[model samples]
Target chain A: MSTLLAFLLSNHLKSRFVIGYTLILLLVSSALFIFTDNPQKGLLGGVNLVLLFVPLVVSLYTGISLYHGEDFTRVLLTQSLSRNQVYWSSTGSLQLSLQAALLVGLGIPLLLFAPGMPAVALLAGASILSLIFSGLSSLIAFRVNDKVKGIASLFLMWLAFTLVFDGLILLFIQLMSDYPIEAAVIFINLLNPVDMCRIVLMQVLDAAALMGLTGALLTEYMGNLFAILSVLLALLIWLIVPMELSRRSFLNKDF
Target chain B: MLHVDSLTKKFGRLEVLNSIQLEFQKGTVTGILGPNGSGKTTLIKCLLGLCHFEKGNIALNAISIKSEKEYKSYFGYMPQIGRYPENMSIGDLFELLVSLRNQPENELDLELWELFKLENIKSQRLGKLSGGTVQKVSAALAYLFKPEVIVLDEPTAGLDPLATEIMKEKIRKESSGKITLITSHILNDLDELCSHIVFLNNHKIAFSKSMKELKASRQGLTLNQIVAQLLQGEA
Candidate 1:
C-alpha cells in the first residue's frame, strides 16, 4: 500500500496542474502579506481566500485527475492487490498531495507573517477542507462514469457546499426569526464543512463580529475548547463519510 | 487450472454475460471468439475481476478468486486497448510494475521487451507513443512478471506484420505449460495459436471444443469457413 501511495504521489506531484496550483497559492499568499499593513487583516484576507478557493480548486483538480487516472487504475486493478487497497491508496495519495501543496503554498507565508494560533487554525481548516473535497470528488468520480457528467456534478457540488448552502441557512434563519433558533442554526451549520471550518477559524481568531449569527452564538454559548472540539468532530465526520462511501463504491465498481 | 462457474453480469437491465461456465487447463491455449458486443471483453474482464458478476465464482487452482487477491499474482493480463498515465515515461512505468511485482531479475521474462526494442524508447512518454507501440508496452508488461495464466485481448489488433509475428512466436513459446486465453476477431491467428476454441454468441458459449475435435467434425473446413457456416445456419 505504501509503495502504491509513493508511486501515485510521485506521478501526481510531477503533473503541471499541481505545480501551477502551488505556485499560484504561494504568489497570492505572499502578495497578501506584503500588501496589507496589519498581519491580522492579511490573515482575514487569507481566510476568505482559503475558504473560497480551497474547495473549488481541490474538488475540480481531484475529480479531473481521477477521471484522467482511470487507465492507471485499470492496470492497478489487475495487480495482486485488493480493490480496497487501490481505492484508498489512490484517494489517499491525491489528498496528501493537495494537502502538501496547501501547507507549502500557504503555510510558509502564514508562519512567516502571522505566526500564531489563529494562523495555525487557518492552515488546519484549509487542510481539512482539502481532504473533505478530495473525498467528495472521489465519490463523484466513481459514482458517475461519464467524465463530463462527473465533472459537471462536481462543479454543482462545490457551488452547493460553498455558496448555496450558506444562502439557504440565512433564509432558514430569517423564516424563524421569531424564535430563539441560535442552537438550531449552529446545528444546521455543522452539516456544512465549509461553515464549520469558517466558524472554527473565527472562534480561534476570537472575531465574533465576522462570524455571522451561528458563529457569534457559538462564541457566546460554548467554551473555546468545547466549541473547537465540536467543530472538529463535525469536520471529521465530513472527512470520513464521503471517503468511506467512495471507497465502497470503488470496491464494487466495474472498471 | 482456471475455473469459471455459471457467471452472470449485467449493465443496468442489459445482460452482457449470462451463466458463463468454462475451465481452462494448463498447457492449453483457449481462443475466445465472438462478434463485437458479444461479451468477449466482458468475460475476460470478469476473469481478471475487472468486472463484477451478479452470480457464480471463479477459482484458480481450486482457490476462490474472492478468497484473496493472491490469485491475481499468477495472472498476466494484456488489455485490448492499453491506456496508461500520460506523463509517465516508459522506463518509469516499467520500473513501477517491476517494483510492484518484486520478482527477482533472473526470473523475469524480458523476451518481449528485447524483441520490441522498448529499451531504445525507454524515455518516451506513454501518451506520445503510437497505438502499436503502446500495444508493445502492454504485451511486455503482461509477460514481465512471468505469470502462470496469460490473458491477451485483441493482442494483434494494431500490430505490424513483424511485431505481430514476434508476439505470436512469443505466445507459442511461453504457452507450453500455461493457461493462455486470447480473444481476437482474426481467426487465422487463433487457428495458429489456440489449442481449444470457445465461441460466444448472444452472451453465452455456443460451443467449446479442442482443435482436433473441431477439425475432425468439420472435415475440410477451416475455422473461418466453419464459423461462417455456423452463422449462416443460425441466420
Candidate 2:
C-alpha cells in the first residue's frame, strides 16, 4: 500500500497540469487577498475556484492515466495477490494521491487566507467535498474507460451541480416571489456540493451571508460542528455506495 | 504442474473453448497450434484468468484456481501484442512491474535484453521500440520473473533471424523444471521447441501427443503433412 501510494503520488507530482494548477491557485489566492475588500470574499472565491475545480479535474485525470498501462494489470495478476486486492490497491493509490494533491494544492492558500475555523473542522468539510467527487469521478472513469468520456463526465457533472443547480434555484425564487423562499433555497442548496461549498465556507467567509435558512439551521442546530459532520456523512455515503459499485464492476466486468 | 480441466469460455455467441481439458508437465514446453480463430488465444486468456471460463475449473498443483492464487504465482505471461504506458521508459516500466510483483526473488531474464542491445534503449519509452524490439521486450518480460509456468502467445510473431534464435534459446533454457506454453501460427518454430504438441481444431483438441509419438505417427513424413492429416481427419 505504501509503495502504491508512493508510486501514485510521485507520478502526480511529476505532472505538468498539476503543477500548473497549483501555481494558478497560488497566484489567484494571492491576488484575491491583495484586491478584495475583506479576507472573507477572497477566501470564498479561493475555495470556490481552487478547491472545487482542482479535485474534480485532478481525480478524473488520475483515473484515465492510471489504467492506461494495462500491461501492468496482467503482470499484477501473475502475483500472489487476489484480483480484488489488485483493483483496490490500484484504485486506492489513485484516489489517495489525488486527494493528497487536493489538500496541498488547496489547503495552503485556504489556511493562509482564512485562519479562524478550527483546522480540524475545515479539514473535515474539505474532505467531505473531496471524498464525494473523487469517488464518483473515479467510478465514472473506470466504467467509461476512455479519456474523452472520463473528462466529459466530470464537465457534465460540474455543469449540473455548479451551474444548472443554481439556475433551477433562481427559477424557484422567481416562482415564489411573494413568499420568502430563502429557507427553501437553503434546503435545495444542500443537494449540490457547490452549495455545501458555500455553506462550509460561509462561516469563514462573510458569516453574515450565512443568515439564510441553511446557514441559520447549521449555525443554530447543533452549531457548525453538527452541520459539518452531517455533510461529511453525506459525502461518506457518496464514497461508500459508488466505491462498492465500482469495486464489484471492476472485479466481475472483464477489462 | 498446470491443469486446465474442461475449461469452457464464450465471447457472446462464440463458444471459444469447449470443454478443453489438458495437463502440462513441469520441465517441458508445450506448443499450442491452431489456425486462426481456433480458440488458441482464448484458451491462453482463460488460463490467465483474464477471461471467465463459464463451465470448467482450472487447478494448479492440486489447488483449485478459485481456492488460491498459486496458479498465477506460477505464471509469467507474454501477451501477443503488448500495449504499455508510452510515457514510461523501458527501465522504469521494468522496475514498475518488479515493484508491482512485490520484488519477487526470481529476477527477469535479461539475456535477450543484452542480445537485442536494449541497454541503449533502457531510457526510451515503449512507444519508441520497434515491432521486433517490442516482441523482444514481451518475450523478455515473460521469462524475466522466472516463474514456474510461462505462457507466450505468438512468441516469435515479429523478429529477425538472430533475435528469433536468441528468443528460442531462452525459451528452451528457461523451461528447466518449468512449463512453457506457446501458441503460434508458424509450425516450424514449434517443431523445434515443443516437447508436447497440443493441436486445437473445431473447438476441441485435435491431438495432444508427445514429440516422439508425433514423429512416430508421421512415419518419416514432415510435421506439416502429419498435422494436415490429423486436422483433415478431425474435420
Candidate 3:
C-alpha cells in the first residue's frame, strides 16, 4: 500500500497542473483567513471554497489520474497483489494524497488565522468531501472506456451534484410548498455528499439558520450530534459504494 | 501445468472465444498462433483472470482461476504495448513493482536488467522512452520475479535484433521447468522457440500439436506454410 501510495505521489508530483492548483489553493486560503475580521467568519469564508472548489478539483484531478494510471494498475494487477488489494490501494492513495494536499494548502492557514473547533470541523468536512469525490471520479473513469467521454462524464457528475441536484430540490420544495416536507428535505440533503458536508459544518459553526426553515427544522429533528453522525455515515457510504463498485468492475474488466 | 477446459467468452453479441480447450505442461513452450481478431489475446486474458469467461474453467496447478487472485502470483504477463504512467521514472517503476509484489529486493532476478542495459536509462521517464525501450522494460519486469507461468503477447514487436535475441534466449532458458506461452506474428521466432503450437481461428482451436508432430505431418513445408494452409482450410 505504501508503494502504491508512493507510485501515485511520484506521478502526481511531476504534474505542473497539480502543483499550480495546490499553490493557488494555498494563496486563496491564506488570503481568506487573513482578511476576515472574525475567525469564525474566516473559517466560514474558507468553507465556501471547500464546498465549491475541493470537489470539483479533486474529481477532475482524480478522473485524469485514474485514466492515466490504467497501465500502472494493470502492471500491479499482474504482480502478487489481488484485484481488491490493488483497487483499495489506488483509492486509499488518492484519498490520502488529496486530503493531505487540502490540509497542507488550507489547514495551516486556518490554524494560524482561526484556531478553534470550527476550523477543525471545517477541515475535516473538506477532507471527507475530497475523499468522496475522488472515489466517485475513479468509479466513473473506470466505467467509461473512452478517455474524453470519461473526463466529460466526471465534469457532468460534479455539475449535477453541486448545481443541478440542488436546483431540482429547490424546484421540488417550491412545487410542494403547500405540503409539510421537512423530513423529505432532510432526507434529500443527506443523499448529496456536498449537502451532507454543508449540514455537518452548519451544525459545528451554528450557521443552520442560513438554510431557512428546512435547515432549522432539520437541526431540531436530528439535533447536532445526530446530524454530524448521519452526515459522517453518509460520507462514508459515498466513499465506499463507488470504490467497491469500481473494484468489482475492474476485476471483471478485460485489458 | 495449466489446463483450459472448454472456455468460452463473448463481448456483447460477438463471441470472442468459443469452447476453447488447451493444456500446457511443465518444460514446454506453447506458441499461440492466430490471425487478426482470432481471440488470441482474449484467450490469454482469460488465463490471467483478466477477462471473465462465460463457460468452462481454467486451472493452474489444480486450482481454479475463478475469482482466484493469489494464483496470479504464479504467472508473469508482458502486455503487447506495455504502456505505463508517463511521468514515472524507470527506476521508480521497478521499485514500485517490487514493493507491490511484497518480495525482498534481493529476490528479484536482475539478469534481464543487466542484459537489456536498462540501468543506463534508469532515471528516464517512461513517456520519454522509445517503443523498443518500453518493450525492454516490460520484458525485464515480466521475468523479474522468475514466475512459474510466463505469458508474452507480441513480446518482440518493438524490440531490436539484439534485445529480441536476448529475450528469446531468456524465454528458452526459463522453459526448462516452466510453462511459457507466447503469441507473436513473427513465425520465425515461433518456429525456433516453441516446442508446441496452438492454432486459433474463428474463435476456436484449429489444432494443437507438438512441434515434432506438426513438422512430421507436413514433409517439406515450413511452419509458416503449414499455418497458412491450416488457416485457409478453416476459411
Name the candidate that leads on TM-score. Answer: 1
Residue A247 in candidate 2, Cα distance off native in Å: 2.3
Regions of model 1 farther than 4 Å from truth = B232-235
lDDT of each: 0.90, 0.71, 0.85
A best-first ranking of the candidates according to their TM-score comes to 1, 3, 2
Looking at candidate 2 chain B, the ten consecutive residues that score lowest on lDDT are B100-109
Better of 1 and 2 by DockQ: 1
Cα-based lDDT at residue A214, candidate 3: 58
lDDT of 2 by residue, B119-184 (tens): 888998776778888888777777766778889888888889888888888888887889889888
Alpha-carbon runs more than 4 Å astray in model 2: A34-37, A50-52, A111-128, A144-155, A165-191, A207-225, B10-16, B33-38, B83-110, B117-135, B158-161, B186-188, B199-235
Candidate 1 C-alpha error for residue A233, in Å: 0.5
Report the error of model 3 at residue A51, Å: 1.5
DockQ score of each predicted structure, in the order shown: 0.67, 0.41, 0.58
Per lDDT, the best of the predicted structures is 1
Local accuracy of candidate 3 as per-residue lDDT tens digits, A37-116: 77777777787888999999999988888887787787777777777777777777777768768878888888788888
The residue-by-residue lDDT of candidate 1 on A1-255, one tens digit each, is 787888788778878888888988999988998998988888888888789898999999999999988877988999988898898889988988899899899999999988989899899889999999999999999999999999999999999988999999989998999999888888888899998888888877778687777877887788678988998998999989999999999988998
The 10 consecutive residues of candidate 3 chain A with the worst lDDT sum are A9-18
Q: What is the docking quality class of candidate 3?
A: medium
Shift of residue B43 alpha carbon in model 2, Å:
2.4
